[model samples]
Each structure stands twice: as structure tokens, then as C-alpha cells.
Target: MISVVLLGSGNVGTHFFKAIEKAENVRVAQWFSRQIDSIKGYKNKTAITDNLSELMEADLYILAVSDDAIATLSSALPFENRLVVHTSGSVNVHDLDKKNKRGVLYPLQTFSKGAEMDFKNVPICIETLDKKSYPILKEVATSLGSPTKRVNSNQRRVLHLSAVFVNNFTNQLYRIGHEITESEAAEFDLLKPLIMETAKKIQTLSPYMAQTGPAKRHDKKTIEKHLDLLKNPEHKAIYKLLTKSIQNTHGR
Candidate 1:
């Protein structure tokens, strides 16, 4: 059995803990946080400690802390040469302290506090400086039911930035759509099908080919009407920028 010491109590840490719990051959050796009360429920399931010095002997240590904290936290670990990994998409694997064997096990999915994520669909991006450490991370990924991909630090950074465009930016657009609908007392739920269909289309068609809108066609009249309808200066600016971007991209 592979023992793991999980360090952190945030969304990624909680979700990862839940995923690894279902694994048959992997066990959480300890759940560490600054405050023991933060992870009270896990106390009965595994060793819970705030003291870095008292960490149990484990085959792997997974740091799910903030990107800035990874270096200091890993550097403070009392032991060296043990397999230490972080669950960060953008942070370089080399960013972890060199005192221990450093690696990354980035789960390419946005985590939320109460949202339950199916590990089967979440891709685990693994990286390691040592060839021998690769199998250990791959085993953890497989055990968690995640599809494993070997991503170098640079590739992971670009992939993560692309995710911001795909996921984060898309969600912000949804918020703007919601605001527009709400202002007119229209049901925002009415757009669910359209949103879902837009996403579904990209599965089979290239996004450029799938694009269909007034902006895509460079309908100057409709674009002007949209800009006029937007009362917020910020919203108008966003509308103009997007419309201009679409026209420029399609050579309209």
C-alpha cells in the first residue's frame, strides 16, 4: 500500500482526499493543516497534525497549498529525499524545495468547496525530475481513477493559461449574459440549452467553424444595437472589444 501525507485543507486538498480514499491500495497517512480544527473529521480516518516535525513516515507527500506557499512548506519538511509533490497547474515542479524529491500531480479540473467531482473525468497531469518517481505519481493518478498525462513544467503552464480562457473567461461571459437577462426580467435559465449546445458543437467542429453570431458575420447594425443596449460603460467596452476581436479574427 502507498501511504500519502496530504498537506492542506482547501478545495483541491479536500477533493483529492476524497478521491484517494476510494482507492483500494492507497491510504492517507496524515492530513496536515495549520489548525487541527480545520480537518477535524479526518482525524479519525488518519493521523492529523499541525506540527511539521511530527509528520509520519510516508511513501509520498502531496502539498495542495497555495502556489506561493509550496516552496516554504516543502523546504520546512523535516525529512529529505522523500517523494514530495504539489497539486498546482502553473507552478513549476522545480519550484518545490530541492531538499526532497520534488514532483507535481496537477489535477486539471476546477475544484469547489462543496462540488463533488468525478475523478474519472478529471485529467491528472504528472511531472517529475526523476524517472523512478514517475511510476509513483502515475500509480496515484490511476488509483484515483484519473487519466494520467506526462506534462513538463512549461507545457503545464500553457495548458493552465489556456484553461483560464476556456473555463474562467467563459464563465465570466456567462455572468454578463445573466446580468443582461436579469435586467430585462428574462429567465436566464432559457439560455442553458444554447450554452450547452455551443459547448457540444466544439466536440465535433473546430471552434472557428462552429462560430455563428452577429459578431462573426460582422453585422454592423446588430453590433451597434448591442453596444447601445449595454448601459454599463464596462459592459459596452467589453461588447465592442469582443465584436472587434471577432471581426479581426475572421477578416471581416
Candidate 2:
């Protein structure tokens, strides 16, 4: 069996570890985390260690830590010849020194602890230092039902930025919408249907083609009224700026 020592049992690590455990010919030899108490449950199924040298038995050490800590943690790991892979969307795979076989296994999706993941549907981008490790990485991803794509460093960085705009930025907009409706004693649930429809329409219609609202139609009165209704300075500025941007993008 190909063994894995997972580092940092955070959201990404937790999710990946669970999925990998279910796969054939793969077993988690151990898990490493700073918060040993928090990740103790994982230790019941496999050995869990706080020491770095305990990772020597595993074929690969998957560093699921933050991008900022990748360098320091990679340097701290003791094994020179063991395959080292980091699961990060933005960090370059080459950031790991040439001492070992280094690679990346970046799953392009948001992971929340205790939430189920359908790895089959999520795209997995893989990158590697040498050809020898490609098969191992690809097999690991494919076994989890994820469709694998080998991406270079530059393309992965660009995709990470785009994902942020789509997932993170769009979520903030939803939060803002919820706050605005609640302040008026209106339930945010009322907007759920409209939000669902907007997303569905955009799947088939080009985002520009699916455009609606006052900004698209140049309904100056409605736009002005919305601006007037927004009492908070920050919210009002955001509304105006987004409206102007939307109009500029889709209007004459």
C-alpha cells in the first residue's frame, strides 16, 4: 500500500484525508498537526504524530498547511528522499527545495469541516517536479473520483485568482444582500428563489446575456431610489460602485 502522512488537519487536510482513506491501495500512515487534541479522532484510525521525523515511514507527506507556512514547514520536514506534496491553489510547487520529489495536488473547491465532499465533480489540478511522481499523484487523485489535470505553475495561480472572484467575492455579495433585507425587517429567505434562478440562467445564458435589473435597463429612477434607501455610507458606496460597474460593462 502507498502510505501518506498528512500534515495540518485543517479543513482541506481533513476532507482530503477522509476521501483518501476510502480509496484502495492507499492508507494514511499518520497525521501531523499542531493542535493534537483537536485532531485526536483521526489518530484512532491511523497513527498521529506531532513530531516531524515520525513522517519517515510514509511515501509521501502531504502538507495541507497555509501558503505562508509551506516554506518553513517544508524545510522542517526531516526526510530528504520522501515525496513531498502541498495542497495549495496559489503556491508554486517549485517553492519546495530540490532535495526531494515535490508536487502539488490542489483541489479546486471550498471545504468546510463536517461537510461531505463529492470529489468526483471537483477538478483536481496536479503539478510535479519530475515525471516519476506524476503517476502516483494522478492515481491518488483519480482514486478519489476526481478527474485530474496536469497544470503548470503559472496556470494554477491564474485559476486560483479566478476562483476567489467566483466563490469568495460572490459569497460576500450574498452576505451583503442578507444584511440589507434583514435591516428592513424583510426575511432574506425571500431572495432565495431569485438567487437560484439567477444562477440557473447564467449556466445557460452568457453572463452578459442573462443580465437584468435597473443597471441593465438603464432605469435611472430605480437606481436612484436604491441609492437613497441605502442609509449606511459603506453600503451605499458599494451599491453605487457596483451599479456603475455593471452599467458600464453592459450598457451603452
Q: Output the number of the lDDT-best candidate.
A: 1
The candidate scoring highest on TM-score is 1
Q: Write one digit per residue (lDDT tens) for candidate 1, span 73-160.
A: 9889999889999999888888888988889999999999799999998999999998999998999999989999998989999989
Query: What's the true lDDT of residue 55 in model 2?
Result: 67
**Clashing residue pairs found in predicted model 2:** none
Poorly placed runs, candidate 1 (over 4 Å): none
Cα lDDT, all candidates = 0.92, 0.87
In TM-score terms, candidate 1 sits at 0.97
**lDDT tens digits by residue: candidate 2, 12-45:** 9999889988888777888898888868876679
